[model samples]
Target chain A: MPDTTTQPLVRVIAAKKDYPLGHRIVQALRGVTLDIASHSFVVMQGPSGSGKTTLLNLIGGIDQPTAGSVFVAGQDTSKLGDSELSRFRAQRLGFVFQNFNLIPVLSAAENIEYPLRLNKVPAPEARARALAMLASMGLSEEAHQRPAELSGGQCQRVAVGRALVTRPDLVIADEPTANLDSATGAKIIELMREMRDRLGTTFLISTHDPQVAALAERMLMMRDGLLCDA
Target chain B: MTSWSLAFRNVWRNTRRSSATMIAIALSCAGLMLFGGYIYWAHLAAEIHTVVLSGHLQVFKSGFKAKGSGNPAAYALANYDEIKKLLLADPVLGPKIDLVTGQLMVNGIITSAEQQTSSTFAGVGAFPDEIERVIYWNPYGLTEARQIPANKHLFARKPELDAADPEGITIGEGLARLLEVSGDSRASLELTALTPAGGLPNMLSATVRQTSIRAMEEIDNHLVVMPITMANDLVFPGEPMHVTAVQLLLKHTEDLHTVEQRIDELAREHQLDIEHRSGWDLNPNHERSLNMLDMFFAFSFCIVGVVLVFTIYNTMMMSIVERTREIGAMRTMGVTRHGIVTMFLQESVVLGLFGGLAGVVTGLVAAWCINHSMILYTPPYFNVKAKLELMCLHSPMIIVGSFFSSFTVAMIGAYIPARHASRMEIAEALRH
Candidate 1:
């Protein structure tokens, strides 16, 4: 329902985000505009402190824009209340963190199943789907391993499976491979691109890794707080 | 995984902290239950003690309390037998009445000729069989102090009057000392009473039958108890018997109010001029002591509850801090703020349930041990040492109330921290 053959999966219009750093205000995003089309792998690449993470957060519906509107999966996320936004995210969007923030208490499979549970999927079906996603991530053997027991690359794979398990319309990853070595980071980026191709879901990832940026279907550059190429 | 299952797993994530918090909860709950058991035991002790001393209710001629002390002979009930019969046969009161008997209050001058001693006596004349029932009214079957070695002498059974020895008498230990008499010595004594109608004196001969201890020192110094017929013969001699008060002992203390109301109705219906006093009214000290104990228990419970809340709060706050990034991740997965709060509260309720159950078990065991240990304690203003006991088994409320209170305290303790965790901005939390 979200892929309007002519419309992009995500549309951000001159979005501005500011933070209060002590007494002075730091503007993280300055009138940034972008569109992420359905089934495309888009990378917002910038140097450290260039506001890529902030832009990704706004498009993820996890944070409200300081100004301008963010439309994801055909809904203006800025206008939604906290609870309404949470439901919208559960139904339409997925997120992957820079540090691979898998729940340390849950096993890899359980962590994948968590989002489906939030979506009110029946337990038996959620479990089956989570196991299938785990197999797809090439982590069938690590299904019962907690995040602490998994290597950095394996944990990121599990994280990717969890984000994609719900079959959401948009998967937003903020520096998903930042914590890995260059070689491992390339592999994670490869796995994500493969998942995107297999599922036909749009992905908007923020990263400074050129190896990851090299494989993006479309690459946008950022300088200071605004996108250099629109 | 369900929310509850995740919450359950999260609790054991830090086993040491969870154990410490549960221990605090368990100890507080046990303390409450134990003290509650003690209070329960005290209630039974006070109840039986009051009933043994004065019975459940007493009916006296109207105005007797105000004027009878000066001239009790003039205020004595003239129709004692009719009232006792009416109480025993009344449909409402018949089953509840354990014993209906009369007591005659008489005072006289007594002389011990051999000791060359003379003293005033304040005496009670009661039917022996009924008096014995009141002396031994142990409905709860609490351990009798008479069986305790240290208390055997003080709580020694009040000697029942011998029917054949109508001239027999029972005097207090202090009175016996003052008159230089002893039950073993069988000292003969004389009593002189003045008739109410005339100043004419009537003399009676009596023998010291038994010497017993009374609870209060002043009362022990002037007490005397004898058969009602002997008292009537000495005070009225050839007149129909008159009783100062009619004592009614009930099978259950709870029925005292119902029986008193029925007595009032009986008095009105029969045109009898009478007033009544319940056991609590007659023994005010016991009621006041129990009331003070209740206040102390409430105060102790509040302190326990407050301390427990803080202990759990500190633990919850620490957990929230450690899990900040994980919480943000969960929110990013579309877990709502309400879901976060529910998860934490579920964890706390689980902690409380386990802790409360452990406390109940420990308390019940401790109570059983103490009940069987036979530890003795001397009560306030009493020389005899009675057994210290707790009553948890017979009172389920002690266990249930302590458990629920601890559970509620645990819930409240988690509320503040859980709310703070839920209110955390998802972006800031992810950064942390």
Candidate 2:
């Protein structure tokens, strides 16, 4: 496909994260290493506490590991301070979740524009971008509706629109289809895959759903916080 | 796209919680403001009393205030014409003096034909024309001068007093009531006081000409206003001299500060003893009222602070817990701990702003309603009657202070929650 070889957008190396659970330390991740190609649709699958979500978090730079390094777009996430990392997240990353965490008070259009606003994007431009994203997601008529007014599928659709509206370098989706029914779940995966194919936007999703795994071009299976198969 | 928009959204998300918090803040501020306004009004009223009744600066004999006894006419300025001419000629002090009048405080027993009130009265013999100039200082002068509604008619100019009749007196309505007399018609009243001549005590009989009201009932009820000539005749008999203190009224009361200093300098230059007293100093109750108000304001501020902290704390705690997964997702999406903190803080400030704005409107309206409706105030040690006052209407400080306090309290309340939000671990947060 059109000379699709490019530098990796995310690089994880020997990442380790430990959490204190009462008396014993729980190792959430243990020395996992991998490189995600630019614009690749990657899926990570594991049971609860298997570090699939942890891997996603490390890649996203939301949490720092006890030991290890994560680089997104060649910038080491561990080296950035809290504020800088936040700016990096706003400027370069987007996220989607199974719960479709749309702010309850904001309408669809406002939800999509939230990140842009946080990044201090000019109001008119942010509005135009949000409206365009809403229309693209078949939510043009529902722009003013809040999350409570939308159905599961519509909320998820709006969530996806919000995640991609900023046109970030990477999109992190953690069990995005877990809350939806099979049919609605499939539609969400289809929409995500469409975005990957059309916009060349890279996606890294953590899930145990076979339906979601089937749609990923690159599948990563994890066991006990370690990568078992790729 | 600004952080404020997000904060605004958060504010609207929990309407009940926000409204409760807002009301608490607004009511506290409004209460403080209204009470503060009352104290201010009382203080102002007292000041008007002092300035209008007593004058800003009084020129007296060297030891007149301390030892002149009740006969201030004893220390009457000898070079009266020269001093008046000098004062009237000074460019700096001339225009600043709104009204320059002379007052002669004398002790006399007011007696009416049918009723004999053998109580001590201070005969405030004043120059009719010049006294009106100085009368600018007294707001309740005419009102308290006479309590009987019908006696209000007596404040009108009396031809007898203006004609330099030696027997003309304008007694307080309370004094008139005490003397068992009325202000409208002429009546013979016996004025008995020691004459300043040779420090001998003398008695004179004067006709009741006019009357006035004053808040200080004692001063009004016993006051006998005789012509300077007549007062001089009865006290200093046949002496071409009169005046206890040279009263100086100012155009603007606030200009007292400037004029007070200038007058002191003038008094020093003329080798005269002129003591300056502000309206506040003369009314001890005004100072006490101000102190009590300040204490109330401080107490209210503390209450507002506590309420704000709790309010923001509750909201942020709930938000942090409810959005655990979202926060985790956001963190994974490259949002840092600081970003999380800022996001939550922004939400708090927004909440504060919205609530504060609502509170300002509510407070102003409530204050207006309360003021217009007429609250009853029955201060002790006085007549048993409810007084009506619009405490908040005329004072601008209360309005502005209340507004700023709300916003500040909101910001203060957001601080801890925002810090806690920033400290969350993305991995742990997501798991929850």
Candidate 3:
């Protein structure tokens, strides 16, 4: 449902992923082809084990397609070495996980500042930017709190702030509000849409929640490792 | 936050495990330091014993060691005065020599008139003042040497051969017991020995001054100390004085090899027919003992190293396993494998530094406690019971060496686990 006339921020051509499970090859993704345009709010909706997570992983460069290419921000991710892909991810990509995977040892502000620090931003600027992101998320009161000390919604907001602090070209969120309550989940989706509109950053979110999928500007559904037109 | 601060925080995440690993490293380091301190104490004790008993170097006429045990007078150096003057006049060797004294060895039979007891005696005649200097030179300030017990005050009271008591002799404790002479009893003895001409036996009347427990327990029965003037008079009667060997003491034992080489050159220049020997040459058992201690230290060090490596390895492996999800998150955020490896290594460095410092403090306290304890034991071939002393060499080399050894082993232990964590699959680790 993406506008094919515009240049794509991510291009997947016949991508396939397989897993070896006890003498059987389980296909996680089979011949998935799609193009996501720049600055678009794209949502991937699928049930458990429907290959939506696999597709998101391929786009984020955290994994490689077994049979085809995944191009993100103009670089073919499958051709990059481990270290190069890591640097590529650091410079051009940001990821938000379903579990709100904040580093338990670091505080809210420190967690947000980490990706900026990875991109070689100076410490003072990184700190100021992290504070700004916390204030934007209404998390200024919880900036010094560790992940364990924060509520689930607060932890998820910190994770989202961390993903956007680097000002990356593409942000990938895999069920970013999975652990939050309905009210908290609706608020997170509103906050993310506000962030996308203000920063003009492209977002690719994968989830089974209809609330998350309903807010998508272009939504794609997957079933049995195959994408379906919506 | 910086990588270092993150690593430091991570180290304390599992408080109990980190402490256990640190304790293992600390104990190993302390054990090595304590054993090294003990070995250092033994070296000093043996050095003092050898140098104090025999001079730093001894000079004898050629063939004296091999054949002069029988009939020492035949190989005696009649030019004792000339050799002494020449040694004192040489600018190169004179300043290094602390003292040069002569000794005349005599084998004779002693008869106590009071007890009517006869015993074989091996006699050494020496200058009273010079002998006192050799015996009382306490450079290391040893407690035992500084305070001689009353019962063993024979050498402490009158180490010198008195010229006034012309025939005065210091007899061994065993010899005095055989004669049944108490410490307060004044007894007269007659000494008889073969004349230098190998003719009839010559006799000298003497009085016992004091009894001593000589160098070894076995030698106490046959030891006798007399004045060189009296021994010469009894041996040569009308001939000039002669001494079997000239003993040379140096200002420092480290100067032995240098002085020996110079002495060799001096002997070559003067055309003197003399052979020189060092203190270690006379006491090879001390060297052998030190070598054995060195081997023991090496064996202990290997054991400690192996145990410490495994302890640190197990700790780091657990840390890696516990933080699998965190590692995956960090990798997703663009942290390179090298960066992850470096972070873990930074944690290891902190742990090693803290453990090494604690070990040094603990070792020092233990050494101090052992040193203050007045434990006593008689070593092999020693007549007196020596006080056990532990002296930690306050050398920076030892402390720094121990610290770095523990630190390096810790780093090596962390290296493998860190690499494995860095190379982990991000997707799999996230699931974990």
Name the top DockQ candidate: 1
Q: Give model 3's docking category.
A: medium
lDDT of 2 by residue, A74-121 (tens): 889889877788888888888888778787777899889878876788
Predicted candidate 1 versus true structure: per-residue lDDT over B209-320, tens digit per residue: 8776545556667778889998888777888988988998898889988998998899899899999887778888888989999999999999999999999999999999
Pairs of residues clashing in candidate 1: none
Error of 1 at B421 (Å): 1.0
Looking at model 1, give its docking quality level. Answer: medium
TM-score of chain A of each: 0.95, 0.96, 0.96
* Least well predicted 10-residue stretch by lDDT in candidate 3 chain B: B145-154
User: A1-230 in candidate 3: lDDT tens per residue?
Assistant: 33434549999989999989999999999999988888899989988999998898899998889898888877898889888999999888888898888999999999999999988999999999999999999999999999999999999999989999888889999898888898898888888889899998899999778899899999999888888997
What is the full ranking by DockQ, best candidate first?
1, 3, 2
RMSD of 3: 3.5
Per-candidate Cα RMSD to the true structure, in Å, reads 2.3, 4.4, 3.5
**Candidate of highest TM-score:** 1
Over 4 Å off in model 3, which ranges?
Answer: A1-7, A22-25, A224-226, B107-122, B145-166, B171-206, B213-215, B218-222, B231-239
DockQ of 3: 0.76
Winner by DockQ between candidate 3 and candidate 1: 1
Fnat for every candidate: 0.70, 0.65, 0.85
